[model samples]
Target chain A: MLEPGQIADLTEQLDTDDAVAIIEDLEEHEQKAVLAEMEPEERAAVESALTYEEETAGRIMQRDMVAVPEHMNIGDLIDYLRKNDDLPTEFWEIYVVDPAHRPVGTCQLSWILRAARDIAVSDVMKREQTLIPVDMDQEEVALRFQKYNLISAAVVNEDGRLIGMITVDDILHIVEDEASEDVLLLSGAGEGDINEPIRDSYKARVRWLVANLATALVASFVISIFGGAIEQMVALAILMPIVASIGGNAGTQTMAVSVRALAMNELTRSNTRRIIGREFRIALLNGGTIAVLVGIGTALVFSNPMLGGVIAVAMLINIVIAGFAGIFVPVMLDRMDQDPALASSVFVTMITDTMGFLAFLSLAVGSGLVSF
Target chain B: MLEPGQIADLTEQLDTDDAVAIIEDLEEHEQKAVLAEMEPEERAAVESALTYEEETAGRIMQRDMVAVPEHMNIGDLIDYLRKNDDLPTEFWEIYVVDPAHRPVGTCQLSWILRAARDIAVSDVMKREQTLIPVDMDQEEVALRFQKYNLISAAVVNEDGRLIGMITVDDILHIVEDEASEDVLLLSGAGEGDINEPIRDSYKARVRWLVANLATALVASFVISIFGGAIEQMVALAILMPIVASIGGNAGTQTMAVSVRALAMNELTRSNTRRIIGREFRIALLNGGTIAVLVGIGTALVFSNPMLGGVIAVAMLINIVIAGFAGIFVPVMLDRMDQDPALASSVFVTMITDTMGFLAFLSLAVGSGLVSF
Candidate 1:
């Protein structure tokens, strides 16, 4: 219920982290107001982090950490921890660093709790520890966490000195974000977060729509080239879409598989030929089965056996084309360093829609079922 | 390199666990052959588990676990573990169970390693432990792993008896599989895996193509209703696709967002209206911006201001439709207990393509740019 103005006042009095929590619970207007109220300096830090794509470690990592010199004894470490009133309330391990502030080992909380008070920090600490670079992608970070069964890891700077620490909590966000992003990309949407504003959503989606529009036009233009065929035989128009629709769908299926394979590092140069060959074979099988059904259906609908034969042949051609475009388009896009999921759908649709119309209409005209 | 026949021979000589490992490394043919070679009783046990969908806890759990009586002490446990030669090579915790073999407590390996030999298991075992059900889905299992920061968890049966055990390794596979599945579904494809055989890939893709074909036919039929308009003026046909393509792409973008929101539990009954409104507004804004550009672009390309105006208006209408259909289609599918990712793309494409064609073609006919 807090108004925007009220939230703004709260930020002026509270810290950024505390303000973030408060804003999270408030209405959108209030959150905006509080954000607006912050002085540019205070606002910039939180805003800069907020500017980072959500679900990244930058968004989830805590700025605070406890570091100790490697030379400290257990007694000295205990004194330092006890004296520091602002230590993180919970931590599973404490980092031990060299004089240069680079971590050399880590001591588990349990080990520290159990060790002799007079023991040196180096004596109790385990030296073999995994270190995470600060700029490493969050997904890779999460992978490391999973691989090593880590509770927390040190985030080091370019110089390999500990700058902060990233914990399981940060990884949790990254896992969720990365998972959600894959889902969004596959669907050809911009950052599809529910929290995004209406205007932002509109802006994000419109570009893709425009792209779809261009592709759809290509399909229509292809059909236009055979307009005489459609006018000569209404049946040709009725049957034409069937070819393109089937092809488009088949292409999508292949595109989805290829995009996923590429994302998972499963589809690579070594397997590209194999995957394409597999998709082509699948398209043929599927086309053969569906073409038989659609052909029979078309023959029945039109009461013309010749018409059904033409549509069926067109269906087979379109489906094969769909399958080819589906796998190849995504694979090519991925190879070109574009996002396979983002661009593949548009390109695949263009190929399927345009080819489907051309195949069905051209076949109809060539067969004299529709005379120009 | 291991052939199916050779793997089958190896399975016969190895224990069940070893057989499972060997099968995992074999080619698909080899894996099937080995399973075929097993005795019916042994095969039934393994096959029953294989029947559970891949990535589920049922497929991932180890049938063997070390369950001890609650009465056993540190000295007794140590002696038992030492004498057991066939135990798993790695385990972090030991379960203490009741007479019925239902786990009541767990003790970490490190605790056991450091404890006095004579300490009672009951006194040292942790009473509060998270237990996962055997049938719990893999995604849920990964969530639990992240939430509790678990190293290992026990899998239980319907009656709450310990049936098997799940470790971090199993959860890792689930995380990867679930993530990949979500991505594939969003792109309108069947299960996608790099290791998947080409034949299977073909079968999975062709069905979707056929479905897409059916929908595309519907759109084409709508266009045929206005075929006279296109025949009268080729310009209408040339411009129609531009409008439709933009709309379809826009719709795809919105649809992607909606599907992701639905998947992440971000868009629910509580926020549906808000999200939809937000998306609608965003669509309108995007439509307005793109409308201006496309309108200008068409005008320049065709050298006809009226045609450009028609294209721009169609673009706006089509984009708005795309946005609405994108969110609504997924939401409706989810409500019907269907996976939003699998069928949503097909449905959304239908909406965009149909609306795109209808809007552009109808507008052209209505504007008197083409005579029917």
Candidate 2:
């Protein structure tokens, strides 16, 4: 993945469909050259695959699969398998099809081998099998595989005819890909692959920074409102970021957990409220602990007991607020039919930062810890 | 996984080895009850397995695999499989063992079914099959399965005797578990399961915040040193967090990419320098774009061109420093044999915050922008 030239080298030697998958990852000009050098049939296969949407099962599935008609007996199936030299190199099961070429059932090799050779293929085949549609998104395909514990599933066209098969190996990659994608998207990094081109990396990352700039101004505007209080006590300026930074971190912790749980199907409508309550209590406990520690450190360093007391209460308040923002932002996004991880950081940080500044400065001014 | 009572109910109906796995996830007291309720032989097996370390193959494998001596012909193997009422309900391959019961090779069911019944198992077996060590870590097992595209692999003891088999279904869970773990750990959140008990969630998340408290003080200490400058020009306080927040975000973006690449085995000794160079150039471009936007925003809002110039310089310097810390911290941790994702946020944020404060304040003081 690091060397483009090496990728081009590897793709040329692989099976045509497999080569197409690798070549699709290359830059456009590199892809053209790789495609042009292929045999016409192979090139046609590759070019047709490129027409499918990115991240669809059509683009990721292997074209090589073993399929036989349902009327064949176990003996005939075995004879055909032995006589054919071009069967797929690896296959755990054979798809049983009808005259119309639609897959009717699947026959695992174990059952076929164990059965008497004279037994009809349809007699031993499993009729209830999962079928993947051609244009199905890869993420949903992975979920179906996970749910059914499928080792291999038949892919069907709109007419319900088998086209290709998706193996467990492909689903493994999709699961990891989707999981890491969520983590990166939450951080506002696009695709976040180390092998990503420099221009693409910059384009993906800088736009998020620009969005952060817009949201950070909201915090700045809040700070500008409290400028008078800050000028009177430089210690407030020193301590303000402590409140915001810790709050931001706490919110991120909650958000990471929430986003992950949603992805795993562990946090759903049936359990969301209960989980939120659990987080709230944990936040209170964490907030109280940090408050006492920060409070003692602040009083000793600044020699101001009242100021320490004010900031301690503010810390507790801000952390609790952070806990709410963390879980709420992602949950709301999910309910709105949006990706739970999309720019969650930007919104959660906005809440925590605003609340942190508001709570600390307002508490100090209200308590007469600082007077202009 | 959500309720102990539900787990107890589910485990009671499963195979003894499977029951043991579910019981092991419970508290010690709960484990005792579950084990006590089991049949004597089942309890003994579960007890022996519990002695092995968590996340090891010993604790997770099914003990009901089909193991046949290498001399058995395909006909006899099929007959033995049919006669055995208690063989594993699901398996893709049959282990071919030597006289001493050590695995010599594997015969995929597909191969056996396709071969003549009179052929010996050894003739049809693949001798180069992957064998998993009994006490191997689950993560290592997953990597092997992924690398070889295995449907199933044999587990062998230290004495080279076959003990059990790990199927692809088990590896699927481990891959998802390990991937989610990295995301959670990077956020300083423990386990991060919504189904995890409230007490457990608190224990995992609070310690990191306390550590954040300690690291955050370093930024505060830096701020206190420049209290005079902040008191003289309060705009410094209003604009300071924008620098730190944006820098922290950029560090997170780069760190997320680097950490994920390392996890995926995409970043390594061969390409580390090239990747670093790529990131450096991207950082410079990102920094320059952000600097221009922030500089213009500050000059217009604050009505102070010199202060704007100072902060723009600080933002650029801090963003570039963030890029270095982002990649360097995780790579160094990887070299030291530590998890690159473990508390990386704490270290990376520490660098960006400290630098954000230092750069903005020192540059202001040096450039006479503060009027102190």
Best by lDDT: 2
* Model 2 C-alpha lDDT versus the unseen true structure: 0.86
Indicate the worst ten consecutive residues by lDDT in candidate 2 chain A.
A1-10
- Which tens-of-lDDT digit does each residue in B1-372 have in candidate 2? 345555656665665457767788788987887666666766676787787788898887777788999889988998887677777667899999999999999988878767777999999999998998889988788878878889999989999999888888778878888888888998888899887788888888889999898888999999999999998889999999999999999999999998988887788988999888888898899999999999988888889888889989999999999999889999999999888999689999999999999999999999997644
Task: Give me candidate 2's interface root-mean-square deviation.
Answer: 1.7
Q: Summarize candidate 1's per-residue lDDT along B117-165 as a digit string, tens digits.
A: 5788888888998998878777777778867767678888889998777
What fraction of the reference structure's interface contacts does model 1 contain?
0.51
Colliding residue pairs in candidate 2 = none
- Model 1 vs truth, CA RMSD: 7.5
Model 1 chain B, poorest ten-residue lDDT window? B13-22
lDDT of 2 by residue, A1-372 (tens): 345555655665565457766878778987887767666766776787788788887887767788999899988998898788776677888999999889999988877766777999999999998999989988788888887878889988899988888888878877878888887898888999887788999999999999898889999888888899999898999998999999998999999999998887778899888988988998999899899999998999889988889889989999999899989999999999788998789999999998999899989889987664
